[model samples]
Target: MLETLGRSLDSAIRKIRRLPQIDKDAINALIQDLQRALLSSDVKVELVFKMTENIKKEAMNTTLQKAKRKDFIIKLVHDELIKTLGGKKAPIRIKPGKKNIILLVGIQGSGKTTTIGKLSQFYKSKGYKVAAVTTDTYRPGAYEQLVQLTKQIGVKCYGNPKEKNAIKIGVQETKKAMNDGNELIIVDTAGRHKEEKELMKEMAVLEQKLKPNEVCLVIDGSIGQQAYNQAEVFAKTTSLGSIIVTKLDGTAKGGGALSACVAANIGIRFIGIGEKIDEFEEFEPTTFIGTILGIPDLEGLVQRVQEAEVMPDPETVKRMMRGKFTLEDLYQQLKSIKKVGKFKQILAMMGGGNIPDALKDDAEKNIEKWRVVLDSMTAEEKESPNLIKKSRKRRIAIGSGTDYAVINKMLDQFRQMKKMMKRFTQMRQKGKGGMPGMPGMGKGAEQFMKKMSKDFKF
Candidate 1:
């Protein structure tokens, strides 16, 4: 996301880190570079200038010496970026033991239907009994589309494809969801464009009749400067609790859409990173800016991992600790990584520094190839990778229709991975009263998340 802007900002920060001294000229040059990057990414000229002005004033006023000055400047820029993107708004959360209704509104092609599906899966994965109610009676197949999307993730959806009255469907479906024991109900409305008066009227009607716990505006990330107008128009019709920006994946206008939406006086609650249902995530401005500046967002990474349920289970952890790691386990690990996100995306969250594009692509391809090769192997061979000797490798390669070298590389990687896991196991065992066992993790995990959200250093 915002790859161009991120690369530009990362380069400037790395340059500062490498520089022996950051004089006045260096600071001015950095500001100029920031302006250029923001402009190139389609950020509103006014917001960019204001952010730079704040950064300049703070950096110039800092009394720190050379070493500390650089740190101060980086932090100043990070904080300013966050402030511009709506700093630290209260997170949108479901009230326990209460029925939560979220109404989503947006213009045509804004990805409202898909986002509702994603939100359903997102909340469902977190243990919420989620259901989606489709009030989009105008759009052809809108209800069916939502049903198909939500069905893949096992989210219940209620809609009347034949119903012309959207408010009726919304009211009835929502009541049905509440009666069905659903904790979270996400309502999808008809997409309204600038010239569509009737649909816009329908939106206000649905909002009034449904009385959603929260009304959310879904804006396309590539809408750029127009996002401001769209957000404002939607706000006038219905009070927005938050905004959800879609199609941010690799979009240059993502920056513009974000700043423009926030400028409309509404905080962004979530961002769509890609087309996948699981790619949508909560928007944290501090972590976002820190990521752009190459800061490691461990909390964000952990959240994704948790959402994906990628953590090793107790049985698997015990097996690894007992040196029972095998190709099957490695295959499962690769699958978990895929579920979490793309390799490059994961790298970004972990502060991946200057990795060559070729390597990133190759790594992604290798994972796909690894999965294929592992699939070709028998259950016995996967359990005992040692059983697959030279002859077995060639046979498996032919069976998978992949190069023999791929299998060789995979085996070598597995060996190195196993060794690393062994070392970590030893280190853990050696510690007196070491890291908490996986079994006792959930008791305080919620409290831990709360504390981290407040005190987490982005």
Candidate 2:
């Protein structure tokens, strides 16, 4: 998400990792590089200086030998980042078995309404009876937009286009949601401009009247330095209980928004990675820093996999364990990958060191091509790939609009996969355990592969 800043920070880390010895000069150079990166990303100058100062003091005072310097520096930077982006974890507060009210507020076009949709879907998927209520009567299409989002996520939405009173609508909808047995009530208020006092007044009324359990300030992550000011205003006007930074994906200034929120003392509760309704995720600062520094976020990856429900069915798992893998199963695997995320994004979560960006891009394209080729093949050909002769290959190539060589390569890949599966099955059957040396892995090898496929999906 913060690709520019991530690259800059990673560059400095790589330099330190390559150094045989880290001295005063090396530490100073790293700090300077970090300063440039954070500044360029619009992180507040004061916070940047403070973080660097802390890192420098700690590094200079450390008596660790040169051999441990690299690890120490990484840990220092990671800890400093976590401290800057909320010292202690502030998890989303949702009271179970009670009507939890979440009031979302932000400036116009800050993704407040869309974030409500994401939050509704998030809570709903967690087994809560969630309902969305739109009090944005001033915005022409705000109510309709929320209605459409709630319908898509299979949640109930309450709004009145004819009513001009936002607080009145909010009060009515919340009461209705409570009476209807909804466990979560998400209220979407009208987006206000900083200069618009009338809209702010309406929001204040709802804050007092509703006494929401959570007053979330939604800030657009691309706003850069302005994010700080926006967050401050919201925090003051509504006593912002938490913050949700939206549109972080593909934003070069995401670093600014996150740092800004932290500087304003607003704990980030969630981050909207994309425009999709399901793109909203809980924010974890340590994991986020690790992600930026090229470390694999195993926890976040697992969460996404679970959200996508990409686990292999028992029947499919049984078939693979029996060494009956086929092109159809491979097609299903590809579909699961698509369900998770883009290949490059998956690679980033798996630690960027494992795959170059160029290869990731090519692999993404190849995956789509593979799906098309599989689609072009007949059901019988997919089940019995051995039956596809030269004629069938040419026909499939023409149907899929791919070169014959691509099809041949896919077949070769399938052959390698089948061979691997067969060997793994044989190893388990012979009771030799995983890889002939790795102990305690009779069938664990296959299970590990399945877990990897589920988590990485690439």
Candidate 3:
């Protein structure tokens, strides 16, 4: 959803690369690009103006010499962008050893009940005894759905579907959950519009009855410009202390929902990236912003890629055991990682464990380029990479919009991995080796060390 925004921002950097100097004209042009991208993504116009003005003012105030000005100016723009998105993450507190009730309230269709399940799982994974209780009597089968979700996550669910009195259900179920020794009790309230007086009042009453530790307003990410109004009304109606934005899977309005958190002076406690229970994430601003700026969160990136469960097949495993790793296996692994996300969705959230700092950026940015390069290779070239002589490299480079040097680098990386595998086999034979469980760490790391060593000649 933020692809357009990232690409637009990248365009500004590319423009800097093309400019002879970071002069006043260049700063104005960059600000215009920034403003256009933010506004087009439905950012509040006033915020855009404010952000661009700040960027321009800072750019003009920089004392860097002409030779070093571009990098500083670009970094200034990136920093300002991060600041626009709250500058930092403040996670919602759900302490252990206490019956911490979290009341989730949101307008209809905000995915509130589902988020309750996700939130429960999140805390459960952190060793908290989690339970889910739903008082969503407004939406038919809402309680049933919540029950199923809780069942899937192995958490106990409370609240009767036929119970129309939300406050009664909330009070009873919340107490029951506490008595049952649940440390984190996520109470799912019925979704209601701010204008729905009866439902709003019921939510307020339920909040008072349950006395939740946190009253989180779950806003649908696609609510766009209306997030502020919804948040404001709910804040007025109840003790709205936290926000969770949901359905951020593909909606362009995601940016608006996120920015609205800042516009309304609220910090987003969590964000739902997909319908899956594990898709929910704590809103960490630095990692989020780093991903946007094409900086790979190596640990996060690796974990996510590994979560895709891409592994070598038996045949490939045998080859790997024999120290015969090949490009074919690497290509399949990379394709699976790509299935997790686009090669470069910088603003989309960003990566892997223990990747060298030097290679993380190159790795994050080159997946797409490598895909093109690999796709341009012939079947024979893939099966026998060493066969790609200078003439073949020249041909492939032209076809892939890359250069011969990059192809050589890739070849070197492949051989390096192969050699590392051979070394592992030799070490095991000599009873002198044990691989670390973590990818890209310890002695085995040499296999992945230079996988994306430096910028490719793309």
Candidate 4:
């Protein structure tokens, strides 16, 4: 969704790279490129102007050292873009051992109920006893939807389909969830704006009665320019303490929604990247801008690895780094990577670049094919891949429903991986930590490691 804007921003950086020196003409051209990108992404004209002015002022005032002028200018532009997106990240402050009442508000069709499920799962994984309360009496099946969502995430939900009062339901649910040892209670409210003025008034009264710890406005990213008006309206009704932008993975106006929130002076607490409950992520302005500017979020990738339960323990990694690994271990690692997600997505995150969807799909298919071949291997063959002779390869290929050449290809890859790991171990022992250029490590691994260490601490 933000790919178009990403390309434009990258192009602006390219303009700077082509310059022989940082001069007034080059700065103007870069600013103009930035302006066009932001405006095309539906950012407010006033906000874009202010952002470009700030960038130009800072770039012109700062004198650069000769050795790394290009890098310094790129970093300057990156920092300024982050500032336009909210300056810094503001995470939700959940109170421990007490009910953290988070009231969700937005207009209809903003994916509020689904977001509640995602939020519950996110907190649940963090060891919080989470619960959901639905006060959305205006929407049919709202209560049932929350009930099912809570069930799926193993969180208790409170709602009464017969109840007509939103405030009463909220109050009752809060007490019930609190008594049941729920540390977090997420309240889902109705978003009916049939009578705009009346709806806002009702919401204000509900806010007064509930006095939630946080009032979060869920904005649909697909709404584009209307996001600002929606957020402003909701903010006026209640204290819209934070924002969560959803449906960012689609061809939505994600750039528009994010920039609109910034212009409205609302801090974004989270963003929904996909429909899955696990696809939600906390909003960080700098990291987000970095990703859009072709800088991958290595930390975020590590987090996802942990979340997917695919990251090996420190001991396993240590052993592998020391060159003690077999085909069995290689198969296990492959399984873990498969569990992490689509190969292309992970690769993109590692490199801080985008991959074509077609290529991603093709890579996924190859991974599955390799998994089949691995499955066909015997226990001994897995532990000692050298035992797989031509006859054994044919047998395994028949079992895996693939050609003998495919099995041979898989074995070759396994051998290459072992070789690469040995090289990695040797390099580390020699105190050459980075992957750098190495025989059998391949250009892909070298490129990946280079991009990873660009901003990664370890």
Off by over 4 Å in 2: 193-195, 297-458
User: Which of 2 and 4 is the better model by lDDT?
Assistant: 2
Q: How do the residues 1-458 of candidate 4 rate in per-residue lDDT, one tens digit apiece?
A: 47778888878887787778888888898889988998887777887898889888977775333324566567767767777777655567888997688889888888899999999998889998899999898989999988988798898889889999887888887888889999999989888956878678777877887778889999988786678899999998798898999987774367778988988899888898878888888888877887887756535533443333332444545556567767656555555554453233333333323333443443355667877888898888887889999889889888999998766766776786677567665754665534554433344454544543342423
Assess candidate 3 and give its TM-score to the true structure. Answer: 0.63
Return whichever of 2 and 4 wins on TM-score. 2
| Root-mean-square deviation per candidate | 20.1, 18.7, 19.8, 17.0
Clashing pairs for model 2 are none
| Per-residue alpha-carbon lDDT of candidate 3 for residues 1-458, written as tens digits (9 for 90 to 100) | 35666667667677986899878888888889888878877788888898889888878986544655766666666667768778554556767797688889987788898898899899888899999988877778887898899999899999977677788888888889889998888888877633588878988888888888889999988777689899998888898887888887767766677888877887888889889999988887766766655545435543443333232244654566566676766555444444442211111111124323343444445656777888899988887898989888888999999977667767765675566557645644564423443242344333222221121111
Instruction: Rank the candidate models, highest lDDT first.
Output: 2, 1, 4, 3
Candidates 1 and 3 compared: the better one by TM-score is 1
Q: Using alpha carbons, what is the TM-score of model 4?
A: 0.62
The CA lDDT at 101 in model 1 is: 90
Compared with the true structure, model 1 gives a TM-score of 0.63
* Candidate 1: regions farther than 4 A off: 193-195, 297-458
In candidate 3, list every pair of residues with a backbone clash.
291-346, 292-346, 298-351, 298-352, 299-352, 300-351, 301-351, 301-352, 302-351, 302-352
Cα lDDT over the full model 1: 0.76
What local distance difference test score does each model get?
0.76, 0.77, 0.72, 0.75
**What TM-scores do the predictions have?**
0.63, 0.63, 0.63, 0.62
